[model samples]
Target: MKWSMRIVMTLTISLVIAVCLSLLPKMDSSIGINSPYHWPSNRIGQVTDNNLPDLLVQVPLQMRIRKVELSSTRMSLDLSLPKNADSTSVYRDLYTIAQTMLMKTKNVNQVWVRVIDYSGVSDNASTQLVLAMVAERESGKDMDKSASELSLIQLEQELQNRFRITYTSKWQQRYPL
Candidate 1:
């Protein structure tokens, strides 16, 4: 009887250890509520010098681009902002947000970002901003160009798959709120 009890206890302990071990990896991969932010070292999206600084260009804008249209050096992006958010904040947010999105595509250049519309704003909370970005692909096939292009394609696919994956991989480790 004592041996049986010991066996049961051993099994329980083993099962508990196994369960705990299994959870470790999942916890690592699973998106945590308050995870540290991380992003690719490289930066994307260059603010055009010639273009007039509109409500855009503010660093670290809260809004993200919803759509991007490209045409040569001229490009437009539809941005989405948080509720009650300021245009300046949106503008600032655009830089990092655009970098996160455009870094995923190879044929992006001369990005033109704009606050196309405001969506879902609450008097109590900051409004969400939606933005559109339009840009062109740089031309060339040299090794550097080819590499950049490949990176762009890969980044684009990653972003298209899920902005959170790309954005979190690049910036915050936590899931976007």
Candidate 2:
């Protein structure tokens, strides 16, 4: 009878532990809705008006997102930045935003980010395309290609090869490998 009681107690303790472990994920705040954990959604390419903002807010954009256009294999983000914003940071923000979007959308292989700034007085208010970047995920063929081929290759070089500055000559010159 004592052995039987011990067995029942052990089983009950094991069951209680299993139930608590199962609830751990739900109790954790790390995966809250405000976070960017909702990746590779089943409805990726089928983006609608309701989900676009949620998708974009995943990244800490340096500027305000003006518009976003999604296609079967591509995502395009048009953003507006303050005229006095730092050029170097904005340049880096381009890559950061693209990477997050690409990772979040399984079907999206390419991401294009455009950042525009406003200038001139009210009468002559003008918008200037200050910076832009285009990034493409690794191709099937490139997957087999080794980065070891280049002796001096670095992470920045590898990232540069994957993503590139576009639309603005001045930014392309200022930003480098």
lDDT of 1 at 72: 45
**Candidate 2 structure quality by residue, lDDT tens digits, 1-177:** 999999999999999999999999987755664344443333443344455666676666667887788887888888877665665456446645665655555666887888776545354256667677778766211432233333333434544566776546644544443
Candidate 1 stretches greater than 4 Å from native: 1-16, 19-23, 26-59, 64-77, 80-100, 103-114, 119-133, 139-177
lDDT of each: 0.43, 0.62
Give the 10-residue window scoring lowest on summed lDDT in candidate 2. 139-148
Best by lDDT: 2
Model 2 stretches with alpha carbons more than 4 Å out? 1-49, 121-125, 139-159, 167-177
- CA RMSD of all predictions: 16.1, 9.9
